[model samples]
Target chain A: MENVVELTNVTKTFKDFSIKNMDLQVKQGFVTGFIGANGAGKSTTIKMIMNLLRPDAGEVKLFGLDYKTHEKAMKERIGFVYDGNVFFDGLNLKDIKRIVAPAYKQWDDTLFYRYVEQFELPLTKAMKTFSKGMQMKASLAIALSHHAELIIMDEPTAGLDPIFRRELLDLLQELMMDGDRTIFFSTHITTDLDRIADYIAFIQSGELVFNQSIHEVAENYALVKGGLELLDRDTEKAFIHIHRAPTGFEALADNMKAVKSIFGDTVVIERASLEDIMYYMKGGVPHV
Target chain B: MKIIISNSSKEPIYEQITSQIKSAILAGELQEGTAIPSMRKLAKDLKISVITTKRAYEELEKAGFIYSIVGKGSFIAEQNLEVIKEKKLKVIEEQLGAVVTNSREIGLSLNELQQLLKIIYEGEG
Candidate 1:
């Protein structure tokens, strides 16, 4: 498996916040979901990948090529969608295409028109007049028209309704049939990832926490519930975070095997969803 | 071939897929050398991530229930039916032995156990 996007020890600093020593890899030919809370440096990391913001320290490469020498070549193969509309507000879809289409050598007018018809987007209406979902569809139509091998999206599902969100996931799955395309999208909506994401890259407060396959996550992390009597200095080592209630105690365990061995059948271990992992992680990563 | 997935089931999606396909092979529904849908195609049709279908197919291959070529898709593997049947029968015998011990401990007669087994077998059909 090749890595389409790679960041090695990347450091970017701002006046108020900084992403420190972040090492991330987006594997080729799969959907890798970028997940974190708002203001968790997801957008900052994406900007670095897009070469809009340069990392202060480390290397950022796309398709094994550095942006310094291959900016034009790399961006040509990468399609991007930002959280907010990056298009001109006054321009209609046709005018937007006219300005954007000339930049890509592989842009296909027929494919663009086909996506326009399939999405039922109004080509004549101003982009500002279109609804949120329509704007997303318009952006997607353009991103997909150029035969891009890598698609990087930041919060692509932020303000859409549930029905359209599902439709968007289905469309992404359809695009993945090609077997050459790679999708890396950041979203707070974990349900969307559950449906289609192969790998999950979870960031926390400007730090890269873990990048693992969804199956690896399922096998490792779990929510364990048991009596408070199970909590001791020795036994508490199994949990990343513990929440106690009058009835019982619920804790997030990073190692399911260790939890099972330490507690045996005394505790009930359940699969932890992505949201649950994120929520429990707010308590802070445990010291090794 | 049709595959029905239950999201609410405790079993993981890939295990569900592997077990269903395994049963299909054992029941002779999918014959030897029958071409199966590609993992990506199956993933798209089932509305699941491609990795899940890939894992299921990999498991099937590991268990000798299927095989795949580099460019070609997966196919049902040549099965040694006698060996598989014997393996399954051995498992059944072990389960039945446990059931007999439990029934005897509860003072149930062999005739009562036979009648119960007949009822369950017919009802399942």
Candidate 2:
């Protein structure tokens, strides 16, 4: 299978938190959601993929084209939407489009007009006068109108109402129906990914925790609930993360058969959700 | 679906899903060709794990209550009406037995328990 985006042993560091030894791939024609907690380095990894930040080690490739070797050509075909406003506040919707459209070789004015009308964005209003949701819609309209084959969205739906959130997801779904376009969606909202993402890649503190098909991720891990005795130091060590409750406890284990064997009758293994997996990866911390 | 499950009920989550789905099929609430929620969606709705929902689905398939066509999805299995009726009655009786056992522990006569059940069923409890 062709990979639209590939990261091998990618690493990035900050003064407080650093993501190390990471690797991931976003396959062609699929929506691969990059999931993580607030400080799990999701944005950091996305930056590396977009080549905004140089990785301390490893390489990122787009359509088998190396980022360093084909930076200009690669970027033209890629639409990047940062988590916040990347356009100037003083720039009106039309002004922003005017500036961005000329940068892409395949920019389509008809497509741009279609998106603007569909999103119901105010073309004459400055970006600062638009609501956050409207600004995001404008950003997306600009991104999608360029005929870009690959789109990298960073928390594009973070502050949108549920209605608009669904709208954006629907747009992406429509885009991917072509079977040639790919979307790299980075968000803390797992529920957004739950609907349309074909694959999910989880990043943690800069490290690539796991990357796999959504079906595989949903099927592999289970929540084992039992008495505290089930989490004997040795057995607890066998699981990824453990959460203690007053009556009993819950833990995520990849190998259910092994966990069952170790704590037969004492532990009941239930299925784990992607949200649960995210929570577990965050050291059982509650989702804020 | 003619199904019963309780978060506080002693029955497991998988049993709740399977038994309800089975009852729905047998009671004609869910038709033979009716599509069921995928394991993942069911889990999300119930806020449980996919594993538990999958187990319920697997058990349903094992009991010949449903079958899944890969990539196409899962549906209720077609069965003879008589066989479906029998399975439904058997499960109903099993539940009635458990209710009777608990009713007896409360020092209620069969007549009184039946009255109480009537009230409960009528939403007068």
Candidate 3:
């Protein structure tokens, strides 16, 4: 698979925080979910991808083209939705369309209207009057109308209701039928990724922890529960982090196979959900 | 073909898909050369990531349960039903051999074992 977006050895610095040596790739024709806790630099990485913030060091490439030379060509193929409404609050949907539609050469009015009707977005209503879900739908309708090859969304589902979130996922699934469109979206809502994301790019404190397929994530990470006797220094090497209670100890193991081999039947190993991984990883990955 | 996915299942979604499709093929519900839904379409219908369905199809192809033509989608493979059935029967026989050994170790007679098997098999129905 071709990488639609690539960042190699990227470094971005802020006064309080900095993203160091981040390497990430968004594969074409698949949904890549970008996940991190608040202030985890997900938005900063996304900004670099969108060319909103240039990385202080390293290369950022889209469709194998560098932003330095191919900025226009690259942006032409991408439809983006930011976490907050980028549209004018006073402007109505029709007016917003008029402003945004001209930016894309391939913008199709028919397709745009089709999405408008499908999403039931009111064209005459002011952006501020629309609910959060409606605003997301409006944004999505615009993002999808331009026949973009890559769709980038930053926290598109952040404030959306469950029903609308599911609708958005279904819509994305339908769009993926084209077999060429790539989607990279950042979200703290891990449940949304379970249905649509093929790859998960997890970031922590501005560092890329892992970019792995959903299957790889499932196979590699697990939650293990066992008696405190299993917590000796030698045996503890199998776990990424361990939580100890009087009754037992629960731990997150990055290597499921190692955990299984080490503890055998003495411990119970269960599948770790994305949320579990994120929660445990917040303690920070120990350099074992 | 209808496939039901249980999010809570210990079995992975791809395994569920493969097992269901395999059963359909073995049960003759899916005939040889019958075209199956494309992986993308299946993923859409199942409300799952395309990678999951892709993995399922790849496993199906590898197991000789199906074959894919470039751009033409996948079709049920030509099945040797007799051979498949014979192979399965051999597995059952091996398992039954173990059961017999365990039963004898427990001082269970052949007649008692036959009665137990009959009851268990009929109970499933």
Candidate 4:
């Protein structure tokens, strides 16, 4: 499959945070999730991909073409929605489409109108007047109407109700039915990725930690819960991070199968959601 | 078509999918040669990732319960009566294997283990 987004040895720096030697790939026909906490360079990396922020070094390629050389053509096929509105604030939905949608060759007015009806967004209301969910829906309508092959979103679900969040996921699922489109969904909400992310890219303190398929993530890691008494010097050393309270001890194991063979039924081996895995891995308590 | 998922369960999502589909086939809910939903369709319906659903389908195919044709879709593979019976027996064999290990650890003989198995098998009301 063709890669929709490829960043090899990409480096970026702010005064405080920087992405260092990051390598990430988003393949066609899959939703690749970019997960990290606030200020963890999720947005920064996304900006680099969008060319909003220039990388200090290395390459940023979209659809097998370098962004620097093919910015306009790449932007035409790509759709984006950020945490906040990137469109003009004073313009209404219809006005914004009149100006922005014309930038793409594949812009379909009928599709845009269809989405407006489905989203129940008023055509005349200024963009700034819409609620958070409405703003996201409007942005999505614009994005989808262009017949985009690659959809890049950063925290599009933030500040939305759970029902709306699920609805948005359903929309993304529907979009990928053709088996050709790809989505890069960057968010702090790992549970959302647990549902629809084919690949998970995790970063902490601006450094890429692990980037792998969700299948491998599920297969490789397990949440092991057991009593504190079970922890000997050898067993304690097995976890990536182990947390102990007065009552019991729980930890994240890098190899579920190995941990299962070692601990067997003595410890509770549970399926760790992306949330649990990210929490323990990025939570950063003093480790064994 | 009927699947109940518990997010809190220790079982992985793909395992839950495969086991549920397997049980349904064994119980005759999904008949032989019946067409199942495509991986992408099933993933969308279940509100899960394509990777996870694909994994489940792969597991089912591995177990000889289903088959997929490229560009077509998956269908439940027909199982002979003997094959089904053998599968049941294999399940029992595993349970008995565990029983033997536990009984041996407690120093029980074969006769005592048989008595325990018989009593437990017949004692269910």
**Taking the candidates in order, what DockQ does each have?**
0.81, 0.06, 0.85, 0.69
TM-score list, all predictions: 0.96, 0.69, 0.97, 0.87
| Docking quality band of candidate 3, CAPRI definitions | high
lDDT of 1 by residue, B75-96 (tens): 9999988899999999999999
Best by lDDT: 1
Clashing pairs in 1: none
Query: Which residue runs does candidate 1 get wrong by more than 4 Å?
Result: B105-108, B111-125
Residues B1-125, model 4: lDDT tens digits: 88877777768788999999988988889999999999889899888888888889999999898999988899999877578879789999998899889889999999988898789889983
Model 3 TM: 0.97
lDDT of 4 at B49: 88
Better of 3 and 4 by DockQ: 3
Instruction: State the RMSD for candidate 2.
Output: 7.2
Off by over 4 Å in 2: A284-288, B1-125
Q: Write the per-residue lDDT of candidate 3 for residues A1-288, one digit (tens) a residue.
A: 499998999999999999999999999889999999999999999999999999999999999999889899999999999888889999999999999999989999999999999999999999999988988888899999999999999999999889889999999999989789999999999999999999999999888899999999999999999999878989988888889999999999889999888889999999999999999999876775
lDDT of 4 by residue, A1-288 (tens): 488899999998778778888998898999999998888889989999999988999899999988768889999999999889988989998899999877889999999999999999999999999999999999999999989999999999999999999999999998878688999988888878878899998888788777889878878878999999889988877788898999899899878988988888999988777788778977642323
When sorted by TM-score, best at the front, the candidate numbers are 3, 1, 4, 2
lDDT of 2 by residue, A1-288 (tens): 489888888777789988787778888866788888887888887888788899888888888898768988999989888878889999898888888888889999999999889988888888998888998888888888888889999999898899889877767766754557888888888888766776788876667777877656755778888888656667876688887888988888766677767888777877777888877777632222
Model 3: residue A144 alpha-carbon error in angstroms: 0.4
At residue B54, candidate 1 shows an lDDT of: 88
